[model samples]
Target: MNRKTLVLPAVVGLLAPVLAACGGSDDGGDAIVVGTTDQFVASKDAPAPLDPAIGYEAGVWNVLRQTVQTLTHIPRGGGAPAPEAAKSCAFTDTENESYRCTLRDGLTFADGTPVTPEDVKYSIQRVLDIKDESGPIGLLANIDTMETKGDKEIVFHLKTPDATFPYKLATPPAGIVQKDKYPAKSAREGFQVDGSGPYTMKPEVEGDQVTKVVFTRNPKYKGDLKVRNEKVELDLFPDAAAMGKALDDKKIDMMTRTMSPEQAQSMLAKPKDGVKLTEMPSLAISYLAFNTDDPAVKDKAVRQAIAQVIDRGAVAKSVYGSTAEPLYSLIPSGITSHTTSFYDRYGEPSATEAAKILDKAGVSTPVKFTLHYTTDHYGPATKAEFETLAKQLNASGLFQVDVKGTPWAEYRPAQMKGDYAVYGMGWFPDFPDADNYTAPFLDENNFLNSPYRSSVAENTLIPQSRREADRSAASPAFDKLQDIVAEDVPVLPVWQGKQYVASLDGLTGVEWSVNSSADLQLWELGRGRDLPEDGVQGEFEEVVLGLDVPVEGHRG
Candidate 1:
């Protein structure tokens, strides 16, 4: 999804001065109101930010998950792909090149129209046909063609063996839309949804931006999910401070997506009477991406020199505080096939090593380039994070970097145009797999939209890893891919984040609300008994404050 930006509990002892008000809703209502800092921008250059074929960010997917129905989905406690719209799905060939699915009985769209297998085929084909550069078409690149039988069965023919195809189908990119409501050849503009998922969406728009989205239970939804609440109100804010204020004012029932590190630290230190904070593990990573085509950083040595000099620990500590951990690889720690290739190759932050690399390549010292970042997307701390990175680079006396900040609306389009020599971006995975980390960044048609490309990694190692049904067995290929990324220095890993959700004490299922991929499963939340001040009694066990809890069958 890119920071699209997607926190840790080890430094729990840290203290912050400011403390916000916290309490539960006194109205005792059945509906839930949640606050988030996620924003979607529609402009002349890039319109239809929420269209399944056009939207690719994590925030965009978060909204699509509740309204759009995919054939397969990751269950509450995530593992393999489970049937959602389809009754069942599996590979039909021994080579894993052919796959098939059968639709469930009486499946209907949100508008009460019957959902046919042709709709599934049409939705997928349109994404490939539109081929928007900023869209999720890259995820479906392996699909050669699709065929449907009558109204029930659908089959997919793949260009290569891909066991991960089911996981890819579980993503919002494969969200099934009614053929009549959505155009076949182009993206449907405006803020609206027409799918057969668990929720029926009603969006509130201010100009081109979606200010709020109201989700009510879809009676026509026939999926694997159990909707706990009748309605959910997702309130979008401009920044973290405003979201926190809404939570304090009791305008929202809970706050998710992002709470600043300082706020989390303060809440951890001082317990509030009716507020509970849950920290969940995430497969999200923030990194620095290089436009290899840009003149400022075209040389591999220049990229390598920046990689050697910048200190990740300092950026994580000073900017993020205890909410994050320094990452040294493209793949995060929890995922399979993770390696410390960058750390192993570069050792530590050293000016001498950076200078030596530049000198060896006959390049000039004090390398000058602009580092661009988004102002409103990741969080308020993003400004500080980029400034800290610039300080680290400048302190080495080997580089002179000018830091620039733009809102996500403009930043993303410019990034796709290869306007920035060095830019900051974050990724929340489409699924919980190492391939999600590798393929999206290193592939020929990468999500970064940068000129960076590795022929061996894209053509050989990535395809080799996907061929294995047992993902753990694919570690060797992924390890080699990580090594290639380290050698190329196209993107430098900065930090791996932990997901945190702050909720009222009267709310249930906070731990299970966000999945391993950092996607919100709001259907799990319900009104329940007032939780104890010290801990929450979850459905499975007692979850205490400051302790990591499992979300979707995996520990955070």
Candidate 2:
């Protein structure tokens, strides 16, 4: 998505009531308490949801981004990677295979230990060494080796010429950690956070689930971001309804990640007192991924037929309302080389067409299969979205679809194990590039851990695209890659989402707090003057207040 601000439609006569209703709270003395539906569950299979090397979900990264500092980070207004812990960084070789970085003078961890090139090397190395099935090892698969040039410089030798490597380093997965604090070869268990970022975290855990995390400004920090809020508290909720209620009761300064369609619509129609809604365009997408090895959907025709019958528009309208739009390609609309490949191939939802494809492949009628989705991960609408999908497929009379809902804790491991014939997943980009959308799902060592693979995408196209220093010049390769995904139908695109952040009228930097990718930049949030009782004097005008950040960038 382009880094630009968006203005919302003006709501006539609604501003006065909203401004009057906006009130103030002195609950956590100068601390901003933010509410979210994002959950972090620590299970036996995934014991360390907060460990940088193991946790790969958006919620985990949300916490990690606040505490762990990266060598390079996306700047506040969403541009190219800027120096964070490092004083400066660049690729040493013309091949884009050898990258180097020089750390800032006197960078130290939260515990006052000075950061070294060795610690940076160890942090990157451990991610590869641990290689957790559900972790972000795929993001670093291009690295051949790492070397420390001096006390402050670190060099990475890549296996291939990957221009996107620096963007990967900007992600939380590549977050720097103290070599001694984190294990060398295993995921560190528990919810403790130790890094050199802008904040110091203190998490409150119940059993394995993290309920609340309190963040305090790090006095020993050095980075690009300015810490606007001295203290921020993130309180977790089970679903959007609970989160919405918390916002209504003045319990939280803001509610982000998700607000249900009904809640968003109601607020938009009749503005709630003291609350302002900011809607930002998102690169985040929700889709269905097939377990290609499973008997039910192993055949390419079976997958294609189901893809043909899915009504993405209906799913977006009926389930998500204005918060989402139907997505037609593996790459969603705002990205560099987005295409309507699915729409071009399928045209529209057609039962007859789907039946013909199934018959041509000699597939059995009423192709009985189960569709699985996570209950709490995406939003309250996910269950409805899948149920609608099942209804759409079953209505076609070519398939008999049964819907099932599982919590993310169990759903993710099951999906990774290829247990679900067809499962729902969402993507928030690791970075703002078409390569992130393709490589992680189509590569041989895919992040999905499924049997699906395309030699064209993995070998030729992906490598060709990465070779271009100018990302736009690589569109042809990405175009072909997206076309290949449409033909194969291993994954079906559903809807592209718009981020909704509901904050009190007095809150400052709500627009700048979340980036385009939907990751929370808590440092951007702060308290500001309350809205005037007379109301905002303007037409329905929406303005992009700050940088577009991720809402909840994860594989939910």
Candidate 3:
């Protein structure tokens, strides 16, 4: 099937916090209830593992991040800096080489141990040196080293100047870990997670069908958003269509990130009696990447020729059916520093132009190559996109395109390693700055490595862009880098994907943020219907908390 099909949820037990009550009024009816169709994929009672290294991307870790603090955090919507685990983060130097953060005190884990700078230092260091197959070590590339200077302060020393350092630290990939709970030198020992967040992992269900994660308000969690409700329980669903059906039947209260384009369209076509739909411009773009090393795709001419043959308009219509929009550059349009380089360099998908380019390269026979795709992730339309691309390329008389498929979980590591001759990938903006878009992929040592022609981005753009503490000040450098990326066709620009959030009418504060990674902190959330306060509080009881996932919001 085309579903992501991650393993299943495991056991369910209560990881009771040392202090569960926030005074007699803590249990009052004021909890904000939210629901999503994504699953935890943890196993049975084996104690749902809490390693931030494993599969902890944007899919679910958003909640866990709110419970346990991070050095920095992108607030729910792409707004200003807000505190969750940190009190404040600021640059100590003008070059943006040195960073410092003051941690909130009186923070304690479920076991009642004080959360101090030592834990933060150890948590990040473990991800850096532990070298487990899991966790987010790749993101720690810019850091030379980090140390705890004071009980309430942690300082990060960079090997090179990088303004995005603070942004990286804010991502859920850097969620705080309990130094005493898991080994700091290797992969997390087991599922029993212990950290200081808003919630704790509860007993998991077998087959991962029904996982019970629990979230309680932290009395000391004086962050930007205060959850109206005290608890949130998440229910896992295997099928997206089935999940949509549940929302219709009210078997579930809400569905977060599990609606297919067709399903979303159908739901939008006919809104339920008490349901609402929130459509917003997501900060992600999906595209086809090329493996320049492969013989079939090795030539620069071949890659450019292929880019010219695929019709972006038709692909967007056929695959998304109006759910997504066409994209032209790595830097999304309308955003500052955006470019039309792809359009300028390759032009529209033209059969005549593509064939001419191929003929000029002296290719008599039809160029043949296999296009790899993923069966899961990014909904069900991906297959159609590939099919259309293949047909267009074949019709050009310049290509004999074949298509291959793999699951998303496998597709990610494979494509990043440049395993596919041509494959698809997506990116969610980690931050709003244009610098965030250009720096990640074209960097010399990026996971995709350097596909573009040699540029100063490696030696200059990276450090210089980072040195500018203000992203707006670094715009010119980012423009230069985008120019480089556009000229280099390691990846062809496709379409900027859109997001549709379907929820019950009672759900308030339904908004979109570029940083969808932090969408699950339900402090300002509330119901619409005129229900008793206890009724809302009862809703909170049903919603479990504590999902240990990574921040994969930028999967573009």
lDDT per residue, candidate 3, 117-224, as tens digits? 888877777777754332345566677878787788888888887666766776554777777566766555333445665555453456643454545655444333
Predicted candidate 1 versus true structure: per-residue lDDT over 286-353, tens digit per residue? 88999999888999999999989888888888877777888999998888788899999999999899
| Model 2 agreement with the true structure over 377-484: per-residue lDDT tens digits | 767778888899999999999999999999776877788788999988887777877888888888867777779888888889999998877777788998898888
Against the true structure, candidate 2 reaches a TM-score of 0.90
Point out the higher-scoring one by lDDT: 1 or 3. Answer: 1
Ranked by lDDT from best down, the candidates are: 1, 2, 3
Q: Tell me each candidate's RMSD, in Å, in order.
A: 6.3, 7.6, 8.4
Clashes of each: 4, 19, 50
User: What is the TM-score of each predicted model, taking all chains together?
Assistant: 0.91, 0.90, 0.82
For candidate 2, what is the lDDT? 0.75
For model 2, the run of ten residues with the poorest summed lDDT:
1-10
Question: Which portions of model 3 show Cα errors greater than 4 Å?
Answer: 1-50, 54-56, 76-80, 131-135, 189-193, 207-214, 218-222, 363-365, 449-455, 512-518, 528-556
Ranking by TM-score: 1, 2, 3
Which one is best on lDDT?
A: 1
Q: Mark the 10 consecutive residues where model 3 has the least summed lDDT.
A: 8-17
**Candidate 3: global Cα-lDDT?**
0.57
